[model samples]
Target: MTNELELKQWYQLLFGKIDSALLELKDYDGNYYWDSVDPNSLRYFVSNIVGTPWQNHMGLSLLSVTDRKLSPQSIYNLMSTINARLKNLFAAAELSEMVEFNYSVVEKYLTGSLMPDHTDRQRQSFLTAYGSFIFNVSKWITTQFTNEQQSYFSKFLFPKLPFDNRDFSVRTKALDVAKETRKTETSAVTPQLPEIRAESHFRWNQVHRLRKAMRDVLEKARHDRITLPLEFSYDESEYTNERWHFVLWDKESFGRYYKVGTSSENEVFLEFVRAENLDDGRPGDGLWFLEILRLRLIGIWDQEYLEDNERLKIVEYLNQWGYEDAVQGQAPFQIRNPGLLTQSVFIVRNSRKFDKLLINLEPIYVACTFARFALDIITSSGARMNELLQISYDKNCCIVTVDNSVTPPSKNYIYRLIPKGREEEENYYMPEEVYRFMSDIVNLLKESYNSSSIPEVEYSAATRKHLMSKKRYIFQYKGRHINEFTINAIIRFLLHGTIIQTSEGNQVVLKAHLLRHAFATHAVQTEKIPIDIVKSLLHQKDISVTEYYSAPTHQQISDTVG
Candidate 1:
């Protein structure tokens, strides 16, 4: 019954008109205009152009289309308007028979083959709105409508769409490369051995010679214009050869050669040779070797074997690819061991524990004071580590609403981190304790620096570097602004002895999150705060996370029995 000619003509006409409209939206910069235009005119224009039941049926009439708009917001508003109309149409009618008809139009519009090319954000917005519409209408028709309607909705409307509804299950995969490496078996040719060996001194001396030889070999290869797969046979009489076999590769395949055992000699060879390739023969093997080389260089520098200028040159060369921390005194390659801090046990007890620690560690009063202040903020405000670091004093004590033009404005939290349009802010209300702490810190910083406006330091996205200001930080250690890593380290050090053994027989290391968990638990369980309130405080997306915190504790059970 459908006319192919008319369908083609209709698409052609709509495409031309929409393309013109999009052109009209171009601003002075040639970017799509985002200013408010007449939404009514736009809707009227679209409806008149489409010239079919598709307009009315999809609720093009109900669109609260704004006049002035930019790329994503413009597209989002249009889809939202269409979805609203679709909801009402599906709710009122028993269009069980028209499932295919409706879907064909939706699919065509969503594909936007005729529409002007738009940004990823615009595309995502359109897809999200369309996806939401399909899900909501399908559910309504199946549940509230007749049996025929349900069958049509379930069979045609739901299954035909090649996307998931919000109700579908999500599978998450945990892939930690480092953790997997620990469990992976070493090649038979390369046996794993303890890092520290009995012949560590002798091995280190051999390693130094090997390092120089490897560098010299690389330099010679560069001079000879030889590519990465360099070739040279080492004679058994190359050195004293006391440790193990002193030979290189066989000539035929030029295959990688190594000793069969897990001795210091093998380790040094493997560390140097394996740096060129992993066992599976992947590239980027040089990185591991480079790390080892840099560490050895640092050790040599630290032992004062190298002059200050020479040490500086070595550091600069190593840091050329951004391994500044590793080349420094910090052990960047150290594996993260799981902590033993538990939630309920630490929170109620840490306050007293921290107080005692402050007294004991009095020589470092600045670090201790900063820790205490940070602890108060985390416990009372429930801000995440990043959010806490980003917080700045505005000097405005009165509750104020934050209006973000790109997103919905919020009045939830007076003290909040306002990021750019791409991310959302979790506005939270500061409690009396947090407010007092802020006041005290602000006054202290003002008196110390003799300035009201304290400039906080944070990393810049453009250059990927930390930029600090001359003014003091609200939370600082040794006169430097405190970062998440520093704060976490401090928290661990403060609660080093505290341990919490879980029911699963695993130890939970006490971290800053333990304090957050404690705060959430106390707020939701003991204080009986609303889960929604808890979510806002914690800046969490769902009540489920807060529920985990509020789960009935062992103490609650014991008290109930008593």
Candidate 2:
């Protein structure tokens, strides 16, 4: 939770009109964008915190941008000399200016491709982690600093050069006011509203997008050999304007026709038909039916989902059992081996082969599978691990309970897990491995950790917020902060191990996320799965994130044209 006091720092910084100091992060139209410093200053700002040697590089780049020290070409050449070529890492002043010049351009520029959904439970968990106070302070400060005319507290809190040591009282008052102002500003901002319209649920400008979504659906329909109606009714009801219901008729099934409708506007075409249409006693229902239609039009559903879902079903079912062997040993992981968790996953997976199908090991398979499934759910769900662990297996379907830490600390986040492809499943669904992993975690936590005799510590909303704080570094490796250097090092190592050839003749080394990226990029490039499925797998709220990661690696892109 970002307290009023915490937000004051950046608020004071901006009020002071200082460029080189720290700034807080803020939500700009549902996304976070930091502003307030000059182009040169911004480089130093980011460099000091994000990268160590930013000043010299920026100074050199500054000379290059202006063509004073070297030709622009020479600057580019000089930049190329750097060993780790960072894309979108070094932002020039003009590019930053262009970001504000047009909002849509800014829309295209999202780091992490993450949207700040204040209302989203998972996002709230994250916001609490990153500290709303500092973020708000930073945003306000950036705005105040960037403008030609500085804001109210500039003269007092942040006096210009030739300052005296005796005037502490005046500066402190100004700082207090700045913090108050930020508290007002952040509290004033609201969450993004659901885009709903008569034509489609999205904004009007998304007509092209609707067409694309339809193209995917029609293709699926044709594949199932399921002919679709001329027009579908989505949210024909008075209250809900976004629910989409497609009047699809499968010629192959006994029901002969399934009016596939999705209450969820963002619902994929496959998920749309899968939900109610599952167990409708029709021959070849569910994903099997959807795939037949999809394949008929697009030629493939990749059957990746079938493997994943089969895994999910086993996991989810095992999660229902609430079982695990008593863990008598020490933690399977050591602080020295963070990647050990990743490696251990494969080891555990291969330990028991899937060959013993329809047997006692099925329960164990389900347990392990759901553990992995739970892990995937949190990653893709974008929720804190603890909040994700709070998912109630007691519920008919695993439903995640979200308790907000800051702002309205009393309110908990409530959301149902949504499954992909198979609409016949729960509202919110977990992948198979997550359920298995979570189940294992439950057993592991039970015997290993002392619950009743555990040392006392506050587990209130405040403490929860502290645990969830982004700065606290849950993903942090031992003796390593979750900063750029470590992240870059990991990516570099992963890249050195893998390589991809793009269509444009660029040979790019594959990074850690490259496989996940491949899952997304290959899906769209191949035109195999619908765009929605690709987005779901990638956990994108909008296509922009999809657009960034969805680009095929060199080889896949090259192979398409070849």
Candidate 3:
């Protein structure tokens, strides 16, 4: 029913817009053009073929062949129909690949109208052949298209695909297999909460020792016992000209010498100047400094001191002490802290003036204390790092409610946080001990700043925009909001040098988000809390997600059966 010129105009309009959008397209990690083989190529890959589950059987070439057989109007109709339906399913500020398409959407709009008389198996096969075409169109619309383009496509696209009223079966073997696989995979990957709980106690003991040593350094720096440009003499002949050095020492030696100094550029440069062979294994006097210094730097040091190119040099220096790829990996040094350095210190390799140099440890002490308190709160409350960082002091975010109905009065510590995916405020409950700890931290912040109340400032997460109205976050240092990187760095600091292995023999790398998983698992499996209640506590939209967190172990299943 369409004229030849009209069909040509539609093709030109649709392809032109798609090509324009593709020019600026990026993947979830901001890699240009999804890091495709050819950035300008419009080809798409279909990994799932109908009969072949193990190999990709089709690509854009197959779709091109199919297009050649169709009339121009039919091709335009097919493309427009798919685009129109997919636009309706698009969510704002979400990735195209992450959108979960329901069965009804896939069936009614995609495969159903095209093959009404075909069996479910036949329709699935048909979809297998053409699914890439639909996916590529959907990706273009959701990820690349502008609001104006989306509106035009939705409103002025071709007529809807014809639909039938016949009943379709809901249950399928593929769906059942997928559900079972998901459950099994989730259970296998979920860290055992009991192991984490036991390991946490040991880690905290190590942290306490490190904290005491840091305090000692701060006190000595204040009293002028430890002077900067600190030199360690070893034979005094073989002088190394490196400006910065990273020294690795045994854990017990960490408390003996915890010195750190900064440069004139306000950069904290840690070094252990040795004139003797490093393999000689003499007890290096200033050897134990870099371990704690690395942790402190990760937690508080400003990242602007080192350029991207300079990071390579720092990584190279760290590698000299057997810390290969330490800066690039999940170690504390990888974290980027936005907080400003309150005091600057640097190490001179072979400078003659060593006595006159003095580096203040007050900033390091404050940063260490902040990191400790933040970790305590995170472990106790099991809050998402961003949710905790965004807590507003001015908004009365924490509330205490007394339940007098019990034999002795009990108080509930409730905190209001704007959880991810939802804009409305949700209440998170904490223990009395955690509430008291939070109060002490608030007092410490107020006293440190010489103010009656904590300062209010805007805080934003790096990944997504937080929807909270109140911007005054309480977890800030020196007028800067503490970031997720800093919190994770604190975790790495606490667990440094200690290896905790999983059941699968893989080493455990502690992170702030992992603590969240530990919390959910403990609540559901250990505490015996009902799954639905745990779902409410986590503010999850679907019970299925909570189910994954609460999946029982093989041992638990065995015990139940027994």
Candidate 4:
């Protein structure tokens, strides 16, 4: 028997603040709703009833009854019975058993007498909500019990509710009744390439415009057309500290400024920049500022405008600012190749300066490039976003295998990826175009680093238990590997202003995972590939999952019905 004191504690935890005969409930938004639910009565409404105000109220009014009323022991016994019935239903091997349990056990607590005036739909809704509430409560109650006590209440130990609280028979019956309705309803379609292509073009165009604006600003600064406070020169008359205010680009009405100075000023500048760029919501304006700053310093050094002492002072400042490779006589850019200027030596050397920098353009630039490359790979190969992001250069991530058995020699481009939730690596087939793209990116990285092979760094994959030391990850910027958040941000930034409407006329938000879905849909629907083949390509364990991607759209449904 369950202890009365413990049951009372559990009751308090489950339902908060029951004053008099009223039971107080809080919605997700923290708003309270009081119902005429009697805690002392033999009958009690089910806990955690969710729906609209009226629906919840109605559901709560329909009580779960037993011979003995409102004691902790009686309530516990009723909940245990419900838990046992649910376990039996979930564990039933045959559909007949499930159907029998539904009628015998489920309908017992949620009897027709409780809602005599309500329709069949209303009764069914209450039944569904009651089952869910009991299941959740049972799970919670099990957590409070000891291991031995849990074993005694075996049903609550691992309570598995059927999908959507509907058994096979219920689903079959529902489908039979709604067959005509489903015919009229349009199934969801995966994202199309044309829409994604348009969005990609928009993003690239924005990047180009930003680059051009940056160059124009740099040219003006170089020629002394506009004065930029690149150095720390205090203005005593104006009572202003030495600061660098970089104006990269500006709209007709409002201008975008990147301010690099003290920590306090950077905070204020960031808010200002956010306000200025609030229209598009694009990130990395601070990164653009840093890039332009690096470029201007290089231009100044190359032009020999500053005297010996002035140049030495600039070098000292660069060293202090955490540019580790900044030598006494050499220019900041000349310390390393311009392409390699934004490497770890520049960014991660000083932790304080890095934090104040707000963002890095190199990572954003690298993320953008990888995202572009990944768009082709994901759409073509049906690779998961994480699988592509976790590819390591040291592991021979991409390989070309030739088949001699065929009449003509065929080359297969295989990308080895650690699939999500699996420790063992899997091979993903790719097109020659994708292979060439990967090669080009690899070559570019090698060139930038001025090395024969891509530099090896420590990488940690989501599936792995430990960090992979000395692995050259292809999807990396500087010393850091680009993450899903950065990639998603870049996708959103690129898709800005490019509108793709849904069948219901709502605007569609593009994501990287949606591209994988698009690839699957295109393979099965557009290419007329076999379901098994599509499933294999998508690396899906179940064929049914793959079929979901190829579901007919509204237009297809309309045409078929016509």
RMSD of 3: 15.4
Candidate scoring better on lDDT of 1 and 4: 4
Per-residue accuracy of model 4 over 1-562 as CA lDDT, tens digit each: 2254235532454343222122332333543323222332213333432221222222222232211123333343434444333444334423232223344444432343332443444334434544545555455434444666445444312223444435434434444555322322212324346556545544444444444444555566569865442222111111111122232322211122323223221211111122123334333232223432333343224344546765566666555433434553434232211322233332322222333332234433444456567776777788887778766665477678999999799999888877755666789988797677677678768866788888766553322313234567786655555555555545544443344555555444456776666677667666789989888888888788777755555666566699
lDDT of 1 by residue, 434-454 (tens): 556566566655655577656
Pick the winner on TM-score between candidates 2 and 3: 3
* Model 4 global lDDT (CA atoms, 0 to 1): 0.47
How many clashes in each candidate? 15, 50, 6, 2
TM-score of each: 0.32, 0.27, 0.49, 0.45
Worst 10 residues of 3 by lDDT: 48-57
Q: Model 2: residues >4 Å from true position, as ranges?
A: 1-152, 156-428, 447-516, 536-541, 544-548
- Supply candidate 4's per-residue lDDT for 74: 37
Candidate 1's TM-score: 0.32
Q: Candidate 2, residues 238-321: lDDT per residue as tens digits?
A: 332233433322222312233322232221121233123222423222111122122111111123334665544433432232
Per-model root-mean-square deviation over C-alphas: 22.8, 25.5, 15.4, 20.0
lDDT of each: 0.40, 0.31, 0.47, 0.47
Best by TM-score: 3
State how far residue 8 of model 1 sits from its true place (Å).
Answer: 52
